[model samples]
Target: MEANKFLDAKGLACPMPIVKTRKAMNDLLSGQILEIHATDKGAKNDLTAWAKSGGHELVKHEEENGILKFWIIKG
Candidate 1:
């Protein structure tokens, strides 16, 4: 899917990916999508829960070559 913004959180650890994703999401209008690329193993779970808790939609996610990609739409 196309995203309004892309965030590279590849080298970031736990809270960092979510932190950056949150900040990036804040800059977008409702229904816009934020695409995040992260290498941290824990980011999948962290982002999934964070998206739900924050009322955003985790529209799509995938793992490729050890990198985790997520597409989230701001609620």
Candidate 2:
């Protein structure tokens, strides 16, 4: 199953994007995928750290057209 979630926090910074993602992920089932779109450069480390601490999985990360994208799976 390729369940996908989208989180758009283009203007938010630091922990905000990751915070919003954590909130959204509370409703997700295990193994569900989340695709986050953020403009903050910190999103890269923030999302990765959160995923590691929370026992989730980070599948991919990239920057395209200035948007920081992340692919994560719920724990």
Candidate 3:
């Protein structure tokens, strides 16, 4: 899991977090991971749904201190 870029949208809200993640994923190469740090309450569900719909994978996610650390592999 090598991440070429990291997007910290920790204080962002709702769709922005997923939007930012999608934009970053579009710019990433296949097999490259995108590390996302966000606090959006919807991230867990949004990211999961996006990953499924886009045919990508969410490798892992951890939430602590009201922040979510997402490790995603671009499809």
Candidate with maximal TM-score:
1
Which ranges in model 1 have alpha carbons more than 4 Å from their true place? none
Assess the local accuracy of residue 32 in candidate 2 as a C-alpha lDDT between 0 and 100.
90
Candidate 3 displacement at residue 74 in angstroms: 0.6
Q: Per-residue lDDT for 5-75 in model 3, tens only?
A: 89999889887998888898989988788999998788998998999899888999888898888898888
- Order the candidate numbers by TM-score, best to worst: 1, 3, 2
Model 3 superposed RMSD (Cα): 1.2
Worst 10 residues of 1 by lDDT: 11-20
- Model 3, which residues run further than 4 Å from truth? none
**Per-residue lDDT of candidate 1, residues 2-73 (tens digit):** 999999999998889998999999899999999999999999999999999999999999999999999999
Error of 3 at 18 (Å): 1.1
lDDT of 3: 0.88
User: Which portions of model 2 miss their true places by more than 4 Å?
Assistant: 1-3
**Candidate 3: which pairs clash?**
none
lDDT for each candidate structure: 0.95, 0.87, 0.88
